[model samples]
Target: MAKKRNQVRRCVKKYIPYELHPDDFLQTMTKIFCYSRWFGVAGSGNLVWKIFGILILLLLAIIEGVAIWRVIKALAGWAVDIIGHRSVTARLAGTMFYASSIVTLILSWKLSSSWDELAAFWASVDQTMAINVPPDKNLKNRMISVTFIIMACVILEHTMCMMSQIGFDCPASLILKRYTLMSHGFLLLRTDYSIWFAIPLLFLSKVATILWNYQDTLIVTVSMGLTSRYYRLNNFVAKFSVAVKKDLSRNKQSNSLNSRNEYTWRKIREAYVKQAMLVRRVDAWLGGLILLSSLVNFYFICLQLFLGITQGLSGSFIKRLYYLVSLVWLCVRVSCVVLAAADINVQSKRALRYLYACDAHCYNIEVERLQNQLSKEYIALTGMGFFSLNRSILLKVRKDMAGAVITYELVLIQFDDNGTTAHIPSQSNATF
Candidate 1:
């Protein structure tokens, strides 16, 4: 725990603020809206204050406009037509998500631009504006160059994954199933609910799956050389029995350690460590977003449960049906958050397990060094130091939700008017 504290303190460009205060609510909520928060911008420095001042607002508007344009194109099927692929709708959804992220980023930027501007905006607008959420200033200011890189990555990652399966002659049905999900999922997101609620639930679900699956992709690249060798030799592959067996069998003949000499073996080992380090760095950068999303998901779980017990029992048929649909969607989104958190932790654990193996040849000095480095913190999705995301955190969330629901239920009893409790004004969730 001290090491984790030190690890956080040492980060110079920390994107998450550790303080808890009035803005913490807005700080937590703002992260959901950031798409490229983790990536650094080029030319963020080197600008003359005058030139930057003149062009910054123009640049922001341009970026926000383009983001909206891309999203509209995607939602309207223009992207689908251009790409000519339906199987990777998640990719499309991701692309749109990143686009909205830009708009959100700008909103946050404007919100925190200066205290004066915020006060003026607030005065001009009504009190109910959702855009009034605050920004996390701990993020470094260089964000201009990051947008293109993220855009390319989203396009290529999903595209290449599908392409590789086709190249390998995997069954078309398997590919179609993954691709068709996004198209339908978006339609499901369009379900009749407050557009606000639908936005986070839908995007959070898709992004969570994308990031979660990415750990598998990361593990596979290293497992071919690093994890696979020892997982089998040390008999540490039981966490995921069937998938481990299948992957072990498929890669059974590809032992780089056996085929390559000590020099090449060291190279492979270094590559694996580098990949693991790279993954940790990315997680560190995205940790704020993950933390806020996880926290928000916790709130959603409580709200969903409360609505189920209250709305499901007393509301009209349409309201009940809406509750059922919203419940299912929220379940999917929360599941993705937990799965992403758990899988990343598990992948690191899988690598760490090899440290305890009996086979000396299956490990080495570099492996030991890597183990020590990982042991200090291991790989975790941390939220601005509020909490570390993992499987167990989900349990903690549910426990908290149970407690909050009981309290809310008791409160609703006081607010109840006559027999129907429907007259309660929907308090805009500050946490949302």
Candidate 2:
């Protein structure tokens, strides 16, 4: 029986690969053999590298946390200066957005470096496939595959967030959006790598969960939106500054009876009304898109949790709770959009105040032109479904002041200061 077994083994060896060097084959076998023995007996030197790698990852996570905190602090300061007294919840939401983004950034770094490490390791392995080191053979090989997979997923997600930030809507934006969305889908496939990279340290890490949740991508989108708001606000403040300057200069030109302030105010009011009307229309479309994306995200999280629980993972309880939390956030997002639409009424009130304040004789031409533009704008906003839904706004603005109901209504839409006149939510409101 021994002679027959030896003959079969020899036949298998001869057919395997003649190109493999005898020295390489021996080295590979020796390493595998040593790993099996070392794994059975603890405290082997081969385990030291694995311990070191884990420590490196943990340290990277800590650094990431600090960076995120700094960003949140900076954003908070900006928000305070801009809005001048936001609610507690707004601050907390900003913190979460910064926090989640920082976490994603750290994970991206780790995954990217890990991929590089794996490539080096893989090259070494292929060079010595037939001849491996005995002490850390299997230990090193296992990490190569794991790290490579993790790295690929993270890079894809980061790319998605970048594309979304560039104003993706339709045609040009739609093409990019599809690509960004595909990256998200790929990240979902590579989720197992994210899980492995995050969970071992027991920090309730959601690097993988958030990628699958598309939270990172959404945060990036919100960041872009916030940035857009910042620019608009800066422009408004600039225009406001210019208007103030013109008003100061006009006080000295009282004899002309038609100084620049009158002209500037009239022009500003007309421009403001036209832009606000456009904003009302865009708001409806933006609101719908956000709500739909939120729902999809909720569905994705729930499905992921269900799959995890069904597969008997240890964290099913936490996963389910997480899904519920995300669901609540989505509901809140929908509510914010609805409230924003309602807030248009308040915005129009502010516009009217500006219109009523203007000088009647010197600003008559500008005022008439602004009123005409407002009429056209009203048609635009009402046509977009936003104005129609909030039909009571005109009546309410008219009820508030009798002297110049139409005029006030026209101007107020663009001059409110409660963070909604711009029609874009402050970064404070959009985070997370």
Can you give the TM-score per candidate against the true fold? 0.40, 0.28
Instruction: Indicate which candidate wins on lDDT.
Output: 1
At residue 412, give the lDDT of candidate 2: 29
Q: Mind giving the per-residue lDDT tens digits that candidate 2 earns over 1-432?
A: 676545544533422234522223223323432342221211122466446434544554553464345335534553222221122222233234334434443333333333334334333433433211122234334333433443354444333333333224447634533332222221112222353432332232223233223322322222222223223323543444445446546664553224333434444554454445434434443343333334343333332232233323332343334334433454444334333344443344344444445444334566566555544553212223423424364354335434343343333222323322110011111213
lDDT over C-alpha atoms for residue 130 of model 1: 17
- Indicate the TM-score of model 1: 0.40
What's the distance in Å from true for residue 263, model 2?
Answer: 2.2
